[model samples]
Target chain A: MTTLSAGKRLKSAVCSTEIMVIAAPDGDVEITCGGSPMGDGATNGGAVDPGHAEGTAIGKRYVNADGSLEVLCVKAGEGSLAADGDALAVKDAKKLPKTD
Target chain B: MLLEMAADAFGDRVAFVDPVADSSITYAELLAAARTAAQAVHDSGAERLAMLDVSNLAIPVGLFAAGWADVPYVPLNYRLTEAEIDALLERITPAYLVTDLTHMTAFGDRQGVALTSRGDFLGMARGGGGDEDYRSMDPEAVGVLLFTSGTTGAPKAAVLRHKHLVSYIFNSVEFGAADEHDAALVCVPPYHVAGIGAVLSSVYSGRRVVQLANFSPEAWIEIARTEKITTAFVVPTMLARIVHALEGQESAHMPHLQSLSYGGGKMPLAVIERAMQLFSDTDFTNAYGLTETSSTITVLGPDEHRAAAGSEDEAVRRRLQSAGVPLPGIEIEVRNDEGKALPTGERGEIYVRGDQVSGEYEGRGSTVGADGWFPTRDAGYLDEEGYLFLEGRADDVIVRGGENMSPGEIEDVLLEHGAVEDAAVVGVPSVEWGEAVVSAVVLKATATQTELQDWVKQHLRSSRVPERIEFWQELPYNETGKLLRRVVKERLDSA
Candidate 1:
């Protein structure tokens, strides 16, 4: 297995977060608490962003948050705001942790 | 380069066979046609030409004509829009655009051959499009300007020479062992190197080529069984679909298959093993090469696959993952960021240098390093046995928090999920970590993102598990059958 450096550890630590995410339409979201910062590392490459990021004090609407998240972006960066609403609908919100 | 040598040595032998139309051409005839085309092109005062329609008959003829005429021929994908073709025409500014009336719109005013007039050429052409007596041309000189499939960005042209194609044929034949009696089936498109290679290799080996106008699972099986195909090159997805199609049907479609070669993207070990089981008698070779090198540089032969695979030995398993040793004439090296060669088993970028190496074309895509070696963006390590193992593309590598993540590694695990049909793992921007490992999956059965996440978390370190999972009916792919990671992500961002 490959070794992870301290900096990578810190990066992974930041990326590995538990948070209650409400998926929003237009890839925009409103984080009630901790989550990855908007535009912190988002790129045009079309890769899925690891919801793991260091959250700052403020929350801004990064995506359009048109109330379109099928599964509440319960975990920041864990998934796309645009998801199969039905697949996520099966989950119970109370079972999710408030902060990761 | 090898083609010329072969032509010189085997001029009168039948070189190309259009199995679809039941026609064949001798090496001498092909050389003569190319020569004639070269003279015609030279007389036409076209220093540079653009070939828009890539029917098998037109491709080799155009290539040889340009070479014989001492001009460069730019190959354009037939799928490109007129505007895109116009833009390319503007960049190359060729004196002529070689195509038939069907695609005449692509060249508003450029001179071309009315393919309707090329009857013999059409019949002799592998897939059978235009029927014209195409001029034969030279063996030497730069020929093709193929564009890269723009999955990441705008497509850029990759310069290809006759030598590149010939050299690949020379090297691959030992592993493939195609002979005059072999009837090879070609289903890949001709615009790309893989497609071009399939056609050229068949011709070079004097084998019969049965062309599939387009790849449909049913059509492939039909053609293979009907034509008694002996060898073929296929992409992973094509293989998967074929396997899926033949799942319960015990048929003779694969009975005549002597060998199966695959590349253009990574294939899961399970997929390959499954293929082995399906075609137990046929030899399997996993090839690894880019368009720049014509087709393949390294191939894992069936023998090595069986010996090194699932040995329960780390060293043996590592060999199984390798792309195999460099071909006889190709030079390969693994280097650090500085371009200095590294010791065996050290991960670094792959660089290839040899007769087969085609320089970057039209100043597009990545630049060649200071040394002549073309920087393969792919990260891999050369082992003590001289085998090369691929990790993934450098751009595709994910650095989550601080740890480097190979999406391929994670993807291999996800492929184990019985419900997963296909999966693409990519890095998304993260404010907290440098990058996040994100996965988009297409499945045979339905599942939620949470379920997938939990499943992945169980198999991998939490750092390697995707922070997000999206389900799609299908993943976007380009013309050459490579997944379009950027397009898939765009759907997510827009969603």
Candidate 2:
């Protein structure tokens, strides 16, 4: 688990000896947990700017085929489970069926 | 001159190390290779040559060869389309094109061959007449023809001379404090003046340069760590990549990293602060200049950063936001519409005159006035202390009821908001206000245009607030990642 924070914390991740998260895009999508809204180079755009949070499992939902939204995040141990907009939150992600 | 100097002093010392393949060329070997290449090209009956490759060992070799052969070298932008290349070829009408024969199909019978195809480059030089001895001649003799980024309109070639290149290297050391031991990692495209400047500075100083054929986040970290890179000349976009790459790591691998130089666009204060935090020991030098000027004319050193943070004086704080003080040989003056120099602390066009500045573009009317000062088209002011602060481009300034409003100031304020990801402000024609302030922003949170407008109104004056606000997924920017104000305005006009 990486400890990520915003602004100064974001910079601290860059130069300091502190462990920081290096997020790579899985295409035009991203997944995050225990990461600050000040996530380095994360795209958060829409009417409501969903602020990122630490320990709050969050993942991006890209517009998909059949005009549906597919969220790319792990639920329980299911590894990269997909859900609609309603199941996008961390709590919903946890409540979904576990694979193991 | 620098190559000759290096050959004389360093001799067998490693002059260039190709980071891509881990190959190197010693100074003595490089001199021989360049001589051989020059002979081969001269033997081929070509009077001039165009190099189409990216940054690598061959660039310097080709440059020296061209110089020794007394032929002009034209560098083609890799980003430009085939049509653009064809157009450039038509304009310059070169006698030969020298690039790696590996990519022979890319040129398609235009010109050139491998340096080894004839014979071992250095060994082949034995019997041929020695390279034509050439002294640096008139400053107007074209050394390179660089094309401007066509963000506003069609691209035009800016004729660069040997004197212009010499001026850049001398002033860069004066401003950037570069040295022979300094290792600079260049991430910008080699086609651009900044990229070329990085290569030239390294060669001129005889320093080790780690050339990135292409920029990758992982590669940047690895290079900085393994090479003990002391300097990184980057665009803001590249810096963003570095920041992103360091996200989950305990610490950046660039412990030996000293300076991160930025230009090509206005860096948001948030970005600067974050970069400073990431590399606590590393200095951030905010540089501002244009390709026409070679590279940098002003640099805001790291020391001023702490001063700006400590002082409450608006002037001191504002210095942090300005373009920065003029480099040693360059003099900048703020002039009014009439071209009369403005008093200190007044806003006007930024005019620069110096030995480092370039002459007028070839076959083009003088951009520099009769007085030898180039009207930079950048709207800025000279503070009482002689620090130069840039507002925006003169064309970007929105004149409403005679008040000069800088969109950059508004954009900076918007970026300060936590919800804002990227912001751009441009002027749109208005029926009532003569010109309306329109803002296009990419937000991190869900917010209405009203919310963003209200946010701006709360922080800025009523007149400065945008008349209309629009949200975009991303802002339109040039290849250098500079926000395109003209495009934004055009989008608004079409909308």
Candidate 3:
């Protein structure tokens, strides 16, 4: 179990999925990938569970039901992202007005 | 962290393009280049990484590389005279200087200076090799050091920390929000605050950027057309020239141009109105901020522009001249001379407070007050409806015979005249009055000095009317569109 924070990049220990935290609620929140705890960018491969084999996609944001935890998928992979065994849902992207 | 976010989120998407070189780099490629450049900067024994070139592919690489190498990125104004550039370069010794060939030879012989041409820098960036990881940088580390245009006094380096810039992006821009096809055309010089802001925000949003080294209305319009540019940012003068260039034509002819944002200088109402009519389909946003504020503390968004233009109500329509509302997490207050906040509609100095507001200079440290408010030194007020209206810089206020008046008020009246294309009002030394209001005007058609003087008198009181009127083919402006009031005053005073 690893603490979550904004801008923290977490890589899957089992699959090729990579996620960056966009928002996290106060206190530590355990983030997992394919039923295994996520690791930092340097973490290598580990065993993958078949139960959570759904994949992640690039440029998509996943958020929990409470909306307190949010992570953006930076790389696509076969491993699904979860927080304490709860699967995250693809957040509906909001179209922001263009301003430079 | 910002560029890394972009690279990881959308690695394959194009991050920047150099049309002159006919080359482009993906976000992944940009990240790799930054890493390599970081290694060179680390190995060069340079304390600060300075870029002294025009907008090019090497710019972004150098910027991110400096951040990755944990060095402050100083983008010097290349338009300055040789002596001025020499002075600034001397100040930042032991600097890794990435400049064009011309400047490299000019300043390369300095002690403890590591020089590389812009092309060779890009070549090195393409060849990826770096040991230091920039992702673990301290939030408080200085990210950029921008020297303010010394219109009033000696240029001071405004420092922007990583937290400030990151907070600005996180608060205002959404991560990975841009569509794959969306692109921004960046024409502002690297020295300008808008230029830096544009690059960072565009990268974080995952939008492609097309750089224009030199700006002309013809070139700008052509690039927007050929590149299918969806969004663009320009100073008021640029938009004015674009509008003048498009005169007598039915439309701008660029269908892909979706949004146009203008700032950096006060925009005349006449120019914006004409531009709105010319680019009828494009959304216009008026962004207002300072170099110390990281960028755009307030923005007059597209909806407000349309509403103000279309509305018949006098109050609603006047918003076209206002600077709009503050961004989220930014607090703006108009305060009187006594440092007391004035009620709405009472004009005073503009002060801003926010996480993104650094308000710190190189040697001066942070000028931010105990309350976290930074005096912008600009004169303006919020209307009853909370729309911020800027009334020129506080130092630019023209005091004539003890009656303090705003040049912006007088200039706005002058611009209302149908014959006047542009106007600048300055206070000149006067034997009779403490200082006399002098006007320098650029006219769209022939108009006599007496006629123009009469025009101001009819619109405002006699005291506000310019005592001396001079007609000029064009008024002096900095490349970024700021009116050179000091230059105007000097010229008129000497004459």
Candidate 4:
């Protein structure tokens, strides 16, 4: 189980995927990619599961239900993301306003 | 962390370009330069990295270097007098100053200060190699130290922490959101918060930034057309000047120019309306914030702009004059002098609280309350629907015969006159009324002082009319479009 914290970057142990924690949950949660537990950027490789091959895209935010967890993908990968045995949905964001 | 993410995601993409110099840098190159410069700053043992020049490549390099070196990046105003700059330089001693060739001799010998010209700084930056451990650094470390413009008093260095800046980005902007073809034109001076915000926001959004060393309406229009700029940010006066440059034209004629955002000062309704007609195909955003709030805390988006312009309801149409609602993570409240939250439509001090609000100064302690709200010192009220209408700085409020009056209120009335182009209302000394209303206006068509006074009298309280009126060709403004009220008072007081 990874202790979720805001701004912490995590890497998939199974594929070429990277994400940073934008909003953390109240407690430690086991997050997985391609049915393999993810690790920090430096980690040992693990085999991918065929059932969880929906893939991920860069620059998209993924969030689970209840609105407590949010992660932003920094790199694309051919592995889907899951937290606590549930799938994370890609958030449909509003067109951002230019704030500069 | 922001640059690291961008470099890792799209390292080969062009990031910053200088049109005049005909040069550009990629995201990876900027990352490398920042790391290399950070190492130099670490080796010199400087407590801070300060930049004192017009906007250039040194800005991005100096900014990230300071962030990576764990020192606050202080951007100095190139427009300041030598004595004024020295007074500020004295405060940030044990600092590394990155300046152009002209300023090398004046500040090179200062105690506990290391200096480099822009030329040498770029050279060292280009020879890039260093390790960055920003992920391990403290989130609360100071990231930027911006001195308040201090039109009211001596400049105070506002402290912005890493968390505050990062929070602002995460709250308002999504990473890598700009399309590949998007190019942004940045022309504001380095000292202004909008300058810094424009860089950081554009970088994180994966937009190519085109820099203009100086601003002229002709230069701005030429670059925007040539570069196919999709997005840009400007202060009110800059927008006004651009509108004037295209005075006889119906459209800006650059189809690729998609978005334009303006802030830093009150935008005259006439100017914005004219700008809308000129850039009919473009989206207009009005962002409102202060140096202490990282940049924009509120935005009136393009859709809202169109709605306000098209609405049949007088109340809905009045939103053109509003500053819009607060950002996602920000909370705003209008409060009276007793620190009590006022109801809607009651003009008072605006207090803001959020992770991005850095209310502290270098020497002076924080003005943030125990509950985390930072008093903006700006007088404004929220409409029933939560649109904020600014009434100018609270300090600028006029006291006429023991009654409080807002100058913005009276100025708005005068501006509604058909012939008046610009106006400034000031409270001058008057023994009878304690403070008398005085005005100086710029007119496009000829209008007499009596005619203007009657125009104001018809719209506002009789006591609100200016006791004396002075007509001038133009009013004094700083580089960022902020009215030099003190200068106006001095000029009119003497006249």
Candidate 5:
């Protein structure tokens, strides 16, 4: 229910998950964690749903099916991420070599 | 946040080492120190945190402390003249200044400044007064401000936000990629972009950092052997010196060294080829980036380097000279002067778009266009396969003897001379230094080259003085009256 621009950090109202937007299409996009809408600086609310008990992994990126939405988990949470009612898939492991 | 992650993952692991001082800090100790030190920085009420010293424990502590304090961390060049450093310090007032013991007495005290020796600062960091809950999570907050000597005017602070640096780390580097035995030798000064990148990247990757405050070929090689170093990043000049130092040694192989990356200036093909032959098993990469991009945006990985070295095709062989493809989440394009994207293999200005790209300065808002692309101003062409070849660092920067100097900085000093009416400084290829500063001037009164050189030496660092100053009747300019520095450089190259 909020504008999701790139670089925006959002928190799940129902979980400890903190995600940073990697890419987003123009306008507002519905993003949820454990069936509850994620928000910027969202406070902890209802319990994590048993149906969404799948935990989010730290340092992994999640993307929507259409590829228009992407978010990276900076911190892990008990609830998994979803975009527009579709569960986001973990992007493939990065192939870029270590250049630092 | 980055440090917190590292501390959580492996608090017992060694995080940093100072070979010169024979000191080291573990991840847990570093986190504790940073948190405590951040309190002092916050209590000082400084708007920014500044460090004017070589790489040491203070470096990581100061950076993390600044992050915790929610202020921009500024690392200044120690090589600049006292007056030059003062000029820069004046710009960032109400600042917390950290310096090594050698510079303890250099500055007495300023009205809006808090100065502390590096040793004392570390004490403060480890003394146990910290805020356990302090954290700056706003991604848009400025993280680091590196002073870049511009092609015109005084050096301006290039801004890097928390997100820019974090994006680079998250995309290019996997968390906890380094094993406990992994160590990286860092020789570049703290002021360079590569140095900052080395610290942040190595820390995030869980590699122990072995820092050498002063770089000597013998010291660098000996430390690598002693520290059991596995990975490292060096600039072109440092690699060249090491290559020369290893000459004629039959048992010169560093088998433990896994990866060796070089950038910050053009790598002489001959130097790289010789090093490759010497260390046949080592992984060599070329990283191309600007301070504004928050470190590496493109990488010429080891595979590409080896492939180019062994390839017989002229184009494939030239890939060694090309900067490899853009990193994931980064996009690059070559465009004509009018900003139209050019086809592959056509020369044009380079522009990049990415979450990591922070094309901003302190006072200036941002150089990025409305479309999110930031013009690099570096002339280059993208090959058919998307390799980027840089014509030079920028059209104007003179990277000489491993130091980057602005032509305008030298030209300004030359113009201060009473005898000079107009001056144009350019870098021309040289045998020893990759590029040597040479200037052409139209004099209003009589002046000798030696006299002008001495004048520059008196005003600025000796390295900035042009090696050669030629008397010219007039300097070339385009129809729009922009000075054609490339023409001057071409004339000097021919001469």
Candidate 6:
């Protein structure tokens, strides 16, 4: 478990997955990959579990329900991601009308 | 760091396309090229990396490389005269200048400067000859040095730091928000603030960018259609020309164009209304900011455009003329000459405060106040609902016999006339009234000066009418679409 902040990058302890925080709520939140807590730096050394092997996709944002916390997948990995035991879903692409 | 984020997020996605070269690069390839370019900059012993070429793949490479190497990226105006270019080059000595073959020959032998052709720079970027790793740069370090378009006076280099740009992107754009098929058309020159902002924001949002070096109404429409460009930004003058180009057509004929944003000058109400009708499927945004404000501080968003265009309420419809409210994390206040915040609906100088508002010049440190507010030097007022209506630059305001008047106000009324194609209002010297409001007009159809004068008198007070009106073939405008009011004032004053 670590304190969450915007722009902080977290890497999977046992996979090639890396995620950067886009938005975060106050308080410590446990962010995990392959059922293991994510670390502060990139280190691709971990076993992938068959049950959690859906993997993260590059260029997609993963967010929790209620849309308070969001992380952008920086690298693809063979491990699914979760936050606080809840599986994060890929965020829906926003319509381009909001583009500046 | 912005490019790094994009590379990591969508390395396999195409980041940019160079149609003229018949080439494109994925985000990963662009990242690698930037790293290599950074190494070359380091090896060249240049304190700053300057690009004087037209828009191309190498511009982004040079921009990101400068950031990676912790040097200020300076993009010079390629349209300037040789003497003007040489004068600017002398200011940023010990610089690595990237240009085309023609300009390289013209400037390659200048002392204290290392010249690299655009082709050579692109080649070096793709060659990946350097082994040095990309270094993280400080957020406070100057990231870009943009020489302001000197509409009023000699150009000054407005400095933008990494923090300001990063904050702007973070606050405004969601990460990885764009669809894979989305591409943005960027036609503005690299030296313009919107050009830099567009490159950074589009890359960070994981969208492909299609750049047009030279702009023409026909070419822009053709390219936008062929490329299936989903989003685009244009200056007001560009939009006006485009509207004129599409005259008599049922629609813009661009089904894929989702959003169109215009800024960098006052957008005429007639032009925007016609644009909204023509590009019926497209969303329109009026983004207002300056070179010192890191692109957009206030945006009349798509929703507001739609609301104003479709509304029956007069107040709501008038928002189409306003610059809209401040963006997230940005605070705006209209202040009087004594620096006191003005009441709602009272016109005064617009002041802004935000993480993205740098307001710093190269030699003149920061102009931001201790309270963090930076007077924008623009005269405007906020509605009761906080929509900002810009009234031209404060210096451009006409003081006629102790009464203050905004040129934008007179110009807007002139533009509302059906016969007027374009109009510029400037303060000309007057022996009796201290200063007089003089107007230069470009008419679409024949209208007598008396008729146009009566049109303004009916819309506004008699004092707001121009003391003298001059008919012109066309009003003067800078390449980026800023009305050359100084030129107009000089001409009218001399006459």
The interface RMSD values of the models, given in order, are 25.8, 25.8, 2.8, 1.9, 1.8, 3.3
Best by DockQ: 4
Clashes by residue pair, model 5: none
Tens digits of per-residue lDDT for model 6, B1-495: 667778777889999888888888888888899998988898899999999988899989999999988899999998888888888899898999999948446787898799998889999899984445635456679999999877666789999998788778766787777899999999999999899989999998899999888889998999999999999999988998999999999899999999999888888888899999999999888888888989899888888899999999999999999998888889999999899999999989999999899999988899999999999899999998999999889888899999999998899889989899889999888999999989999999999889999999999999999988999999888888888888999998988
Span of ten consecutive residues with least summed lDDT in model 1 chain B: B128-137
The residue-by-residue lDDT of candidate 3 on A8-95, one tens digit each, is 7788888888887878988878888887888865455566678878889876789999999988786778888889889999987654
Q: Give me the iRMSD of candidate 4, please.
A: 1.9
Report the C-alpha lDDT of model 1 over B1-495, residue by residue, as the tens digit.
Answer: 223434544556665545444656666566666666655566666667666654445556666556666677676776777777666667766455666536555355544322222443333433322224422333335667777776666777887765565456544542123455677777777676777777566554556566665678788888788878888888878888888887875543477888787878766666676677778777777788888887778777777777765478877765655677676568899987788899997878889986677766676543655666888888888878888888778777778878877787788678878788788888877889977778889898877888888888899998988888888788877655577767765666454
* Model 4 misplacement above 4 A: A1-4, A10-18, A27-56, A75-80, B130-137
Candidate 6 chain A weakest lDDT stretch, 10 residues:
A91-100
Best by lDDT: 4
**Per-residue C-alpha lDDT of model 5 across residues B1-495, encoded as one tens digit per residue:** 777778866779999999778889988889899889888898889989999998899999999889888899999888777888888888888899999747544653766778899889998897784578835467888899999844356788999999999888887887777888999999888988778888888888888999988888899899989888898888777887798899997645688998888887656566788889887888898988999999898899999999999999988998987789898889999987689999998767799999899999889879999999999888778887999987643557787988877675577568768888678888999889999989898898999999999999999998888889999998775321246676798899899
DockQ of each: 0.01, 0.01, 0.32, 0.52, 0.47, 0.24
Between candidates 1 and 5, the one scoring higher on TM-score is 5
TM-score order, best first, reads 4, 3, 6, 5, 2, 1
CAPRI classification of candidate 1: incorrect
What C-alpha lDDT, on a 0 to 100 scale, does residue B251 get in candidate 5? 41
Please report, in order, the local distance difference test score of every candidate based on alpha carbons: 0.61, 0.64, 0.88, 0.89, 0.84, 0.87
Question: Worst 10-residue stretch by lDDT in candidate 4 chain A?
Answer: A39-48
Q: Model 2, range B364-434, lDDT digits (tens) per residue?
A: 85587778899988888877778877778887888776677888778878887888988888888788778
Instruction: For each candidate in turn, give its C-alpha RMSD to the true structure in angstroms.
Output: 25.6, 24.1, 3.3, 2.2, 10.2, 3.6
Candidate 3, B181: how far from true, in Å?
A: 1.8
- Candidate 5, residues A12-58, lDDT tens digits: the string is 88888878788897787888888788886566658887877698977
Looking only at chain A, give the TM-score of model 1 against the true structure: 0.19
Which residue ranges in model 2 land beyond 4 Å of their true spot?
Answer: A1-100, B43-47, B100-106, B110-140, B174-181, B248-250, B309-314, B401-403
Model 1 misplaced stretches (Cα beyond 4 Å)? A1-100, B1-14, B17-24, B101-140, B162-178, B250-253, B308-322, B340-346, B363-366, B445-448
Residue pairs with backbone overlap in model 4: none
Error (Å) of candidate 2 at residue B36 is 2.8
